[model samples]
Every structure is written in structure tokens, then in C-alpha cells.
Target: MQNTVTIGKQAEQYAYQLLLQQGLQIIEQNWYCRQGEIDLIAQTNDTLIFIEVRYRTRSDYGNGAESVHYHKRRKIISCARYYIHTHPAVEKCMIRFDVFSMSRDSAGEFSSHWIQDAFQT
Candidate 1:
């Protein structure tokens, strides 16, 4: 696989592990719908989380979190709605969105930021 794709996968895996360590139970990963894709979907107590995982080797153009543009957010919201409509088991759960941004230094040591409740609409 290309390095960029590998990096994205690794970053998402890292995000999933991090959330798990933070006491979030993994409900799913790489969830997709016609509207969009959610990198990680998890549940913590009463909240069902839809996470967007972004990573950049360097913040040249912008930080990883900054890459979640308006169009992307709209798609995510649409997908989340579709997921809820299909998964009645999660219908009553509180839905929340999160974003995890990862950046690596020259030696490839990652610096991560977990933004809880990153956005709402």
C-alpha cells in the first residue's frame, strides 16, 4: 500500500486504541454509508461516538483537525443519521462527534490531540 494510505490506517488504529484506553468500548471501526465514512464508532456509557481520525506528517497546509472541512462534516452528519436509522439498537443512545488529530515529528514520534465533542449541529 502507499505510505499515505498506510499512515491513515495506522493513525486510525492508534485513535481507536486510544479511545479504548480512555474507557470507550469499540462498537465499530471504519463505518460507512452512502453519505460518508466514519473512522471509528464507539460507545462510552450512554454516549455513542462517531469519530473522525486525521493525521499529517507535518502541518504544512494545515493541522489534521483543520482538514475536516464543511463538506466532510455534512457528509459525516448525514452518515450518522443513516447509521442511526438502520441500527435501532443505537437509536436511543446519545450521539456525539469526536475528532482525533495526529502529527509526527521528524523521527516519527506521534503527537495526538483528542477533541471530545469536537463539533455539533
Candidate 2:
């Protein structure tokens, strides 16, 4: 069985490919700050997006996106703020929070759901 970190890396890689295919310019991956980490950072047009990638092998508790609760959202937001502070060039761009939810079924097929503007600051 794959460990959680391995599964997460796979999921994030899948999400990265999907975003690239959709024409979003990926700026960074696994960006970290004192508050927390942002899974992926991308830009589409004038929008600067902060993405949170969640992966789950089962839905017994909930799907991946559902796992990003209020506290998690707050942490992501805080981290995004720190990111913007450090990267002044993107400060004038419109900011958006996104979620890339991935799940694997019994057959080992992976599925992804991309939620644009998944949360707010």
C-alpha cells in the first residue's frame, strides 16, 4: 500500500497536469509560509490562485474537498496572505482560493474535481 505522502504527491501531480491542460500557468508547488502551506499556485488571466489539494482513498468519512474545513481554510488563507506579502508583483492581481479534490476507487482509478474559488479570505 502506498503511504499518505506518496498518495498526496501523486494527487498533487495529477492536479498539476490537469491545471496545465486547462491553460493555467503554474507558478509554484507546495509553497510554505509560517502559517501553513499552499499546495499549488497558478494564474489564469489576471487571477492569482492559491490551491489546496486533498486526496482520499475512500469516502467513508467524506470526500477530499469536504475535509478542508473552516480551520483549514483559515490556515490556507493566512498562508496566502504571507505569500502575497513576499511576492509583491502579484499583489495587484485578483486572488482566488481553489480546491483540487482527488479520490481513488477500488479499481485504483483516480478521479479529480477542481473547485474554483473554493473559499474566501
Candidate 3:
């Protein structure tokens, strides 16, 4: 069985490709700070997007995106704040939080969903 870390990496990679295909420029991936980690960061036009990538092989507990609870949202938001503080050029850019969920079906095929403006800071 693949570990959680491995699944997370795959999900983030899939999310990155999905975003790129949708015309978002990759600013960074796996950005970390004392606050927490932001899975993927990208830019589209004038918006700075902070993305949270979630993956689930089974739905016994819940879907991937549903796993991002209030505490998780707070951590992502804190990390985003740190990112903006360090990158002054994008400070004035509009900010958006997104959630990308990847799921593996019974046929072993993976599917993904993108939720724009998933939650507010």
C-alpha cells in the first residue's frame, strides 16, 4: 500500500498539471513555513492562488476535499500569509484559496476536482 506521503505527492503533481493546463502559471510547489505547508501556489492574471491538494484511495471516512476542515484551513491561511509577507511583489495581488481533490475509483482510475475560492482567510 502506498503511504500517505506518497499519495500526497502524487495528488499535488496531478493538481499542478491540472492548474497548468487551465492556464495558471506555477509560482511554487510545496511551500513550507513555520505556520504550515501550502501544497501548490500559482498565479492567474492578477490573482495569487494558494491551493490545498487532497487525495483519497477510499471514501470510507470522507472525500479528499472534505478532509480539509477548519483547522486545516487555518493552517493553510497562516502559511499563505507568510508567503505574502516574504514575497512583496505579489502582496498587492488578489488572493484566492483553492482545493484540489483526487480520488481513485474501483477501476483504479484517478479523477480530480478543483474548487475555486474554496474558503476565506
Candidate 4:
């Protein structure tokens, strides 16, 4: 696998562990629809969470979380809607959008940040 893909996978695994530690139950990953892909779908305290995962090796451009552009938010929101349509019970549940970003050092150690409700629908 490409280095970036491998790093991303590791970051996702780390993010998943972080979420679980926070008492979130994961429902799905890499959820795809005509609109786009939702990196994660999870539940906590009667709330459904849609997550976006981003990893950056360096901040030369900017932090990974800042990389989520407007178009991407629209796509994620649409995908969340599609997911809700597929699961009507969840449609009525409180929804939150989160972003998890991982910044990696040369040693491959990563510092991850969780930003809840980072964007709105």
C-alpha cells in the first residue's frame, strides 16, 4: 500500500479506539452513497455521529482538520441524510458531525485530535 494510505489506516484505527474509549458504539465505516462517503457512523447517548477522518504528515499546508472544505461538508451531510433514510429509527435521533485529525511525527507517532460538531448540516 502507499505510505499515505497506510498512515491513514493507522490513523483510522487510532481514531476508532479513541471513539470507543469515549463510549461511542460504532455502527459503520466508510459508508458510501451517491453523494459521498462517511468515514464513520457511531452512536453515543442516544445520538448518532457522523465522523470524518483526516491525517497529515506535516503542517506544511495546514492542519488536516482544516482540509475539510465546504463541498466536502455538503457531501458528508448528504451522505448522512442518505444513511438516515436507510435507517429510519436513526432519522429521529440527535445527530452530530465530528472530525478526527492525526498529525504524525517523523517517528510515526501521531497526535490525534477529536473535534465534535465541527460542522453543521
Could you tell me every candidate's TM-score relative to the true structure? 0.94, 0.97, 0.95, 0.94
- lDDT per residue for candidate 4 within 46-115, as digits (tens), equals 8999999999877888787899989989889999999999898887799999999888776767788899
**Taking the tens digit of each residue's C-alpha lDDT, what string does model 3 give over 1-121?**
7888987787788789889999999999999999989989999989999999999887888888899999999999999999999999999999999999899778766799899999998
Ten residues in a row with the worst lDDT in model 1?
103-112
> lDDT of each structure?
0.88, 0.93, 0.91, 0.89
Residues 1-121, candidate 2: write the lDDT tens digits. Answer: 8999998999999999999999999999999878989999999999999999999887898988999999999999999889999999999999999999999877887899999988888
Residue 95 lDDT (model 4): 92
Task: Write down the TM-score for model 4.
Answer: 0.94
Q: How accurate is candidate 1 locally (lDDT)?
A: 0.88
TM-score quality measure for candidate 1: 0.94
Worst 10 contiguous positions by lDDT, candidate 2:
103-112
Top-lDDT candidate index: 2
Whichever of 2 and 4 has more lDDT, that candidate is 2
The TM-score leader among the candidates is 2
Candidate 1 clash figure, as a count? 0
Clashing pairs for model 2 are none
Q: What is the lDDT of residue 46 in candidate 2?
A: 92
- Tens-digit per-residue lDDT, 48-96, candidate 1: 9999999987687898888998988888889999999999999999999
Candidate 3 minimal-lDDT segment of 10 residues = 101-110
